[model samples]
Target: MTLAWLCLMWVFLSATVATLPLRIQFIPGAILLVAGPVLIIVIGLQVGFVFSVIALAAYVSMFRNPLLFLLARLRGRKIEVPR
Candidate 1:
């Protein structure tokens, strides 16, 4: 289905962004980060909860470092971003 293709494209894009330098990746990475949840929601509605959960797990693992950085900032921990 179309949704499956979209998910595949998202995975490919995420992998491509992962290979870029951290600084260079910030923009596209953030975009993907935001889009991920929306994509998962759509998947859940179209397919099923199990597939969406799997996608979410993959998303979390892929963006683990960025997610952690955001968590630290939220907790008021003075974590420095690597240059």
Candidate 2:
């Protein structure tokens, strides 16, 4: 299913980002953090809660990077990672 592919890709991207050296790792993490919510919003609109949850988890993991966290905090929003 499309949702399954999305989840798989999310895992792959996360893993690939994590394996990269520090200088490059941030790029993929930033991509995941920014792009994930958009993907979630798109899929969540048509699919269901399951895909949204997966996307949210990936987004959180991406944003968990300290640099990303500080950016999010600067904007003054709660760093939500589901329940």
- Best by the lDDT measure: 1
Candidate 2: stretches off by over 4 Å: 50-54, 66-68, 71-83
* Lowest-sum lDDT 10-residue window in model 2: 60-69
lDDT of 1: 0.92
Tens digits of per-residue lDDT, candidate 1, 1-83, equal 99888888989999999899989999999999999999999999998999999989988998899999999999999997889
| Best TM-score among the predictions, by candidate number | 1
- Candidate 2 backbone overlaps, count: 0
Error of 2 at 31 (Å): 1.3
lDDT (10s digit) by residue, model 2, range 1-83: 78668767976887888788777766677777666677788778878889778767757765666656678889997895432
The residue pairs found clashing in candidate 1 are none
TM-scores for all candidates: the values are 0.93, 0.60
Q: Relative to the true structure, how large is the alpha-carbon lDDT of every model? A: 0.92, 0.73
Q: After superposition, how far is residue 34 of candidate 1 from its true place, in Å?
A: 0.4
